[model samples]
Structures are given as structure tokens and as C-alpha cells.
Target: MGRIVLNGVRKAFGEVEVIPPLDLTIEDGEFVVFVGPSGCGKSTLLRLIAGLEDVTGGEISIDGRDATELPPAKRGLAMVFQSYALYPHMSVRKNIAFPMRMAGLPEGEQKRRIEAAAKALNLTDYLDRRPGQLSGGQRQRVAIGRAIVREPSAFLFDEPLSNLDAALRVGMRMEIGELHKSLATTMVYVTHDQVEAMTMADKIVVLRAGRIEQVGTPLELYRTPHNLFVAGFIGSPTMNLIGGAEAERHGARTIGVRPEHIASGSPDGAPWVGTVGLSEHLGSDTFLYVHGTGLAETVTVRADGEVPLRHGDRVGLTPNPDRIHRFDAEGSRL
Candidate 1:
């Protein structure tokens, strides 16, 4: 029952308004991700829901009750921050039990919740160790365990994996995804990393400068973006946007085609031809950066690893006509 709804929510500081009035509904048990570039106010929005920050206007509803004026402690939500924020002197067990102890739960109940959280986070053996003795990932798990014992209706994560190394981030990402499934609780996670949002979220809320650029499932946003901002931002390596003569031929102000959707071979009889400026062979896939196509940016093409193309070679590229995306002068999909 962790449904959260925001109606005309806005946030301001003095004369500047970071988040403008907006409406959003996060359904119960959905793993929703708020993702955007820096200073986009995704974290501020999350803080408003957690009651850590007050809204300048509008109402926030958690479940069925309005929580706009509630204090952070009474919001019934758990937040895991970018930093672990663990007490270096405290053991894992003590760290996890702090919340229950503050609420004056019985000794037995505190112990019960601590053990359950430890087991769930795979920290059963490390419970007696201090935060200083654990690895980065282990310490993060301890932080999550501390949050889990609160049994809040929803979990708020603010770039929880940003502190870890690449390998560790991947490991923790999968762990959090598993945690969501087992708990079946609504989770609102914030990250600037689109890869994280694409892989972990049931729904993604894309933001820019405090406003939502788009909201949909990973594939929905990938397959059919609402506008140029979304189309250019959503994909890896980005979709190639061509304008002027090429776009005019397609009866559009601009045309977009993904790298993988384009086929490359001999320059003869090809719709578009260019010289390969650079080529990257990454074992499983090969990427070619093509130049002299007359576009503002070099065209990037993803080809098979076995493709015998290299720098300085002439190549032809033909996009899958059915897969090409057309856009209007305003960057809206056509």
C-alpha cells in the first residue's frame, strides 16, 4: 500500500523555482526510477516525498493520507543515501538495531529484526564486524539492512551505487532488484545513470531541469521517444540525427536512426557513403565512426565484431527504412 501521488508539486528557494508544478503517481509495489542530468531536481523531488523538504505548493499523498505537512520520521518511508552514513564504531548488528531501539522496542523484537535483516542482506556472518572492517559493497549492504529493519512502506534510494566501483555497482544493482521483488514494496530510486534506470526499473521517469522529459517503461522510451530530447538521451551511443537534405528526402525536418539499425558494406549502390575515421573492435561488437557524411557530427555505426572494416576505408550505410524515425521542426515525433 505504498502508492504515492503528487498533485501540482512545486519547490522553490527565494526567487528561483527548481521544480515547477507537476503531477505524478507512483503505484503500489512499482520500482520507479527518477533519472536525469545533474541539477535536474530528482533528489529534491524525492526529498519532498520523504518530508525532508517542504513543498512550496500542492499536496503529497502516501497511500490515502495527505503527508504534505508530515515530519520526516512520520512519513513511513526509508531512505538510503549516496553515502552509507554508517557509524564507524558501531557493529553491523548495532547499526541495524538503532532504529528499533530508538522507538523503544523490546530487546527480543530488536534482536529478531536485526537477525532477519542481516540474513536478508547476506551479512549474517559479518554482523559482529564494524563498518570499518567491511568492503565498500559490504558496508552498503549494512546501510540497506539498517533501512530494511524499519519495514517502511516505500524505499527511497538516492544514487545508492554511485560510491562503488563498476563491478560492485553492477552487483549491488542486481541485489537491489532482487530486494524489490522479495519485499514487493514501492521503491523510488534516483540516479543519473540511464543504464541503471533501464536495467532496474519497472517504470522510468526521465527529467531535465526539474521537469519530466518522459515517463514510460525502459523499452517504451527506447522504442518510441516523445521528442528529440528523449530520442537523443535515451539510447546508448545515441541515435544518429540527420537534417537538411537527408531529412528533406524523408519528408521531415529531421530524421533519426540507431547505429544498430544501419547496415554497412561496399560504398557502391549504398544510400549513404562515408570514410571510416575510426573503428573499435570490442570482441563482441565493432563500432565505426564515419566521417565526411556532411552531418554536424560524425556518424557512428555498430557492426558485427567480424566486420572487416577499419579506419580510412570507404563504407556505405543503409538504415532500415521501417526503423527510421522522422521528426518535425520542433523535434516532436512525426
Candidate 2:
């Protein structure tokens, strides 16, 4: 019953429109992620849904009820922010009980919910400790425990992991994914990190300059991007794009091939010839940056970690014709 729908939703500040009219739907128990570069309006969209910000036009509905004009507290949703906004003087138990206390729930109900949330987040032993006594990860769990106690219809996460270190971010990411499964609640998360989006989302909405560039599963966007912006942005190390004479040979204004799709040795007739400029061995895979290729200035290739290739070595590259992507002059897929 956590379904949320936005119909032609728009947001603006004075005269500058940050989010153009757009429509999106989040199904019950689905984990949806909004991702893009900074100032892409992902957070703004999340705020609009949370009722933290107002929309300039259109409607927002939660479970078939109009909530566009509802205040944040009345929207039946809980938000976890980038910062762990806990009261330093309060114990973890008190922090979690704050929400229930504000709503004037009975003491017995508050105690029950707090205990349940503490155990679920593995904070039972630490419940008596204050915020100053916990690590970064523990404090974050306390914040989430607070949200869990509220038991809102849906959860809104605004870059919740951004404040943690790399290792902690990874751990929290997995924890949040597990939380969603156990709770079976709809969750809307926002992040600029594509890796996080790829690992956590059931559906990903990619945006740029207030407009959605693509909306699909991680693999869908990776395998078949709608346009050049998507193709160049979705993958790690990025897909190699070549223009000029080489692209014309493929009957396209531009051509794209992912690093993993390019074989080190050319096939029957070599389409690309270069010298290895740099090689990176990451134990599991080797990435080679090839120079002097007639196509692009530099072509990146992913090869076996055991590949015996070194800098300045002459090399040949051949892309799998079936996997090659062609783009028109306007950067649209051909």
C-alpha cells in the first residue's frame, strides 16, 4: 500500500525551474533509486515527494490519496538524511522513542517498538549508550532505528551513506538492501554514485538538469542506452566513443564499444592498431589504455589479469561486431 505516483510534477525557485514537469511511479515494496551528477535535481525530486518542498504544478498521490498539499508530518513517510541527526545527550533508546513519544503513544507501545527496532538494527546492547559513545556506523543505525519505529508507509533516503567512509558505506549499503527485503516497504533513495544505484535499486531513474535521461533496471541501461549521454554515463571506465573517419567506416557518425568487448588481438582484418600506453593489473582483471589508434586518441581495453602486455608494446584491437554500438550525428542510437 506504499504506491506513490507523480503526475506532471514540476518544481521551481522564483523564475528558475529546477525540475520540469515529469511523471513517475513507485510500486509497493519496490526499491527505486534516483541517480545523476550534482545539481541534477534528484534530491529536489525526493524532497517534493517527502512534502519537504512544494511543487510548482501537477499532483502527487500516495496510495490513491492526494498528498501534494499535505505537511511533511502528515504525509505518512519517514526520511533518513545524510547526517545522523541524533540528540547527543540522548541514549539510543531515547532517540528511537522520540518519535513515538511525540505522537503520544502509550508508554507500553513505545517500549515495545523501541525494543523491536533495537534488536532488528543490532543495537540492543548499545541502547543504554549515548550517541557520543558509538561509531559512525552505529550512530547511523540508531538513526535508521528511529525511522523504523515510526513505521511509515515508505522511506525516503537522501544520500544516507555519503557521510561514512568507503568501507562503512559498503557495509551500510548491504544493510539497507537487507532492511528493505525484511520490511517489504517501498523505499526511494537518492545518490550521485552510480555504483550504489547499480547495487541497490530494483529500478533506476537517471536524471540530468532536472530531466530524466533514462529509467530502467541497471542491466537494461548498461546493455542498451537510449542515447549518447546515457551510454557514456552508465558504465564504469566508460564506453569508448570514436568519431571522424573511423566512425564513417561503420556507417555511423560515431561508434561505441565497451572495454570488455574489445579483444586484444585483432580478428581476420584488424580494425584498430595501437601501442599499449598504460596497463593496470587489478588482480582480477587488466585494463589497457592503447594509444596511436587510428580511431580515437586513446582506446581502453579490458583483458585478463594474466595477459602479458606492457607499455609501448604493439597491439591490435578488434571489437565484436555484434556488440558494437552505432550512434548518429546527434548522438542517438542507430
Candidate 3:
């Protein structure tokens, strides 16, 4: 059982509190991702759970036992860092065997586990090579293989894909997701990239300034955000927030509509009308930035890839009323 619970957990450095008291529960076999902008304290929280850092207040429990004071080695958990952390001089087989060797496992056991992890990670043919001989993705797999040998109740990942290029990041995302399915082990991942969080997590914990803004499935956060910060941060291209007279007419201090929810055309009585300032054709979809709509900033609309709307052309936009989001003056969802 890999269930982890934090009760009134807080962290402080000298006199300043970084993480205020908070409670969270990560269920067994669940893939949870903590996401936020830089210095949001997502990594700090993960380290608290890993026992690498002690909580300033309250306690932590793993499988129902208090582990607030346990050292990292006694916590029965494995962590994969942003860095590969492999010994360059060691061969792939020996790199994976390092952990088992440190624990004084028998030679036969070490060989067995190394071979099994290698086969699972598609490194069977590369076992004789050194870390210097592999690509970025291959080196990362070796790091994970090292963790797999520990057989911990849970796995913690600290931005494991940030070092790779965009294409490699996408491939590794799928590989990690597949690994979770095959292992059925609880995994907690951390990242600043919302796209990665949306694609890989069973549950997502959105944090900001050391506090959790929300916790729910990807779609839950996407469909109904708790507040303005969440609404603006969770979506790609982000939701357009309109204020002033346009918002006052709707009986809200501010109004929000996603790009995809707004349609572009030349409807005579459309709610918003503006000139297309720029159009980006990305093959699958076209993103149009419209100006002069009498709102706070440029309104972006997601139109068909083949949209003929060009710069200097006037266009009308209508948002689906049912999909409109209203916010109060204090930025809370109404």
C-alpha cells in the first residue's frame, strides 16, 4: 500500500514560512502531479513527503504509519530527479546494479533484477554500453531503471522530462505513463508544464506560493476552476477575461470565455467584433488574435485550420452563453 497523507503540514526557513499548513492525501496506485509556476513550492512539498526535508509542523504518514522524522533511506520510497545521476564510467548493467550492490544483495539477485528492469525499459540490447554512449532519453531510462530495482511502495519524480528536448519529452511522457500502468504503483510527479500534467496525471494538484489552489482530475479543473487564478492557468492559450462595461452588462465583475468556445464569423449581430491582427496556421488549428473588440486586451479565437480570415479583415465572435464563466470582483467564481 502506497497511500500517503499530510496533516497540517508546514515548512519554514528561519522566520519565513514557505508552505503554510495544508492537508492532502495521495491514494494508492494513483498518478498525482503537482504543478505550478516557478518558486511555487511544489518541489518542496514532494521533498517533505520523501523525508528529505523535515516538516516544521504536523506530521506525515505512509501506509498509516507516521514518517515525519524518518530519514530518507528508511522511508521506503524511490525518487527520480531531473538529472539522470548515472555514473559515467559504469555500464548500463552495472549502473542499475549499483543500488542492489549497496544494500549487499546477493550477486544472483542483483543480476536478476537488473535483467528484468532492462527488458522492461527496452534497454536489453544496450546493457553493455556506458552512459556516455546513449541518447538523452536512454540515459533517463537508466535513472528510472535504477529506481525500479528499489521496489518501493511509491515513486517520486522531480521534473524528470525538463532536460530533454520537446520531441523527447513527449516520448518519455508516454513511456512513464505506460510504466505506471504496468507497475500499478503509486507515483507522485512534479512539473511546471501544464501540458505534461494534463497528459500524465490521474489527479492534478495545482499549487501557487506554497498553497494548493485546487486538486482534481485534469478535466475537472479544466471544466470548472475554483477561482480566477485556476481558470487562467489550467488551459492552453488560456481563457480570455473581459472586464468593464462588457462584464457589468453580464452582472459580473469579469467574464471569461475560452478561445475554442468563441466562434469567428461575420454574423451581423455578433456580440464581439474586431479586426484580425494576426493569424497563426498550425496545420491542425488556426489561432487568430483579434483587436479593437473594446475589451482589456487582444481577444484570441481558435478557428478552423483552413480559416480564410486574414490580417486587416473584420470578424465577428460569439461565445456560447452556456460556456461563459463569471467571476466576482474578488476573482472568485460566482
Per-prediction TM-score: 0.98, 0.96, 0.98
Q: What clash count goes with each model?
A: 0, 0, 0
**Candidate 1's residue-wise lDDT over 55-142, tens digit each?**
9999999999999999989889999999999999999899988888898989998888888888878999999999999999999999
- When summed lDDT is taken over every stretch of 10 residues in candidate 3, the lowest stretch is 294-303
The residue ranges of model 3 lying beyond 4 angstroms of the native Cα positions read: none
lDDT (Cα atoms) of all candidates against the true structure: 0.93, 0.93, 0.95
What's the TM for model 2?
A: 0.96
Residues 1-334 of candidate 2 have per-residue lDDT tens digits of 7999999999999999999999999999999999999999999999999999999999999988999999999989999999999999999999999999999999999999999888888899999999999999999999999999999999999999998999999999999999999899999999999999989999999999999899999999889988888888888888999999878989999889999999997423677889999899998899999999878888999999998889988888988899888899899899
Which regions of candidate 2 are displaced past 4 Å?
A: 266-269
lDDT (C-alpha) at residue 329 in model 3: 94
* Pairs with steric clashes in candidate 2: none
Per-residue lDDT of candidate 3, residues 157-202 (tens digit): 9999999999999999999999999999999999999999999999
Name the lDDT value of residue 43 in candidate 2.
98
> What is the alpha-carbon RMSD of candidate 3 to the true structure?
1.0
